[model samples]
Target chain A: MPIDLDEALKAIAHPVRRDMLSWLKDPQRHFPDQEHPLEIGVCAGQFDQRTGLSQSTVSAHLATLQRACLVTSRRVGQWNFFKRNQAAIDELVRRLGEEL
Target chain B: MPIDLDEALKAIAHPVRRDMLSWLKDPQRHFPDQEHPLEIGVCAGQFDQRTGLSQSTVSAHLATLQRACLVTSRRVGQWNFFKRNQAAIDELVRRLGEEL
Candidate 1:
């Protein structure tokens, strides 16, 4: 099924999620460097630090974004690296223009 | 003050709000005829009918949309006519492209 706009909007409604997007824009600047910054995005630990939120809260927020298709993640070792899903973001804008 | 993306996204997150946007796209088709269709958008009664929600609920949803700057309203007699805020919607898309 196609993603609902309401669900997607709700997922990104939190301030932390917005901050996550900003941080993802310049991962190296906002987060600690990993072994492969290019291959792996920011880890949940780094995201928790940047947002000053509890690790569980950050994890929950990341899960929300993942459900909304706003971000994609890759498992590297015991860490999950997350990067903004540019295609999904672009598609959201396109759909809003068409639907709204 | 500039609108926050998080706030706006939260406001439009409700299913009723999304339905409101869809209804506003074709007011006459979804809503009952009023005195001035062009001058005023759909009223609460018509909206309540289309959404099958309580009047108070529809009113609250409209208020949410208004807060998000996704829709604008004009008072007509005892009724408030709400229309989609195209400019604000466009600006939202633009900002998402720039910021997201």
Candidate 2:
């Protein structure tokens, strides 16, 4: 599905959510201790551990980003991993260049 | 002045505000009736006349965009002309590409 501009903007509006995106962009650098291979992206537990926030809070933020199509989530056994949807991000920039 | 990512995102979150940015981007095309020269940009009244919205409401939206550095405002006589700050907008896109 195509990403919605309004939803993407609203998803990244929060500071924590924005930070999460930055971390997700370079998982190897930001989350070196992550056990899962970098190819699938970081797991939800890593975010909970790194942010020191409640699991529910991290889940909510991740849900928002997923809903916006900014990030794609994958299930590996019991954990959900997330990575930046580069195509969607590039599309957003292109749209902003043309529309904004 | 640097355009803050959060502010710009928030500023463009609203549909009307996003449309205003689009209109400002091509003033000659979108707002032909604007009395002011295209160089200085469209005046506040043009937005009101074009959208059939109240002056105060338009002013508020303009203020939000200006605050976010998405648009630059110039005062000519009693009218405030607003134009897209292309450099700032580009900077915002670049930041999103790198940070988001």
Candidate of highest lDDT = 2
Q: Which candidate leads the pack in TM-score?
A: 2
Q: How high is the lDDT of residue B29 in model 1?
A: 72
TM-score of 2: 0.86
Write model 1 residue lDDT over B1-100, tens digit each, in one string. 4666876788767767877887788776776565567547877788777778899998888898998888888997888888998777777777776766
Model 2 CA deviation exceeding 4 Å by range: A36-39, A76-78
Instruction: List runs of model 1 lying over 4 Å from the truth.
Output: B26-29
How many pairs in model 2 have backbone atoms within 3 A of each other, for residues 3 or more apart or on separate chains, i.e. clashes?
0
lDDT of 1: 0.79
The models' CA-based lDDT, in order, is 0.79, 0.88
Tell me each candidate's i-RMS in Å: 1.9, 1.3
Q: For model 1, what is the alpha-carbon lDDT of residue A9?
A: 82
Query: Which pairs, if any, clash in model 2?
Result: none
lDDT of 2: 0.88
Please provide TM-scores computed only on chain A for all of the candidate models, following their numbering.
Answer: 0.87, 0.93
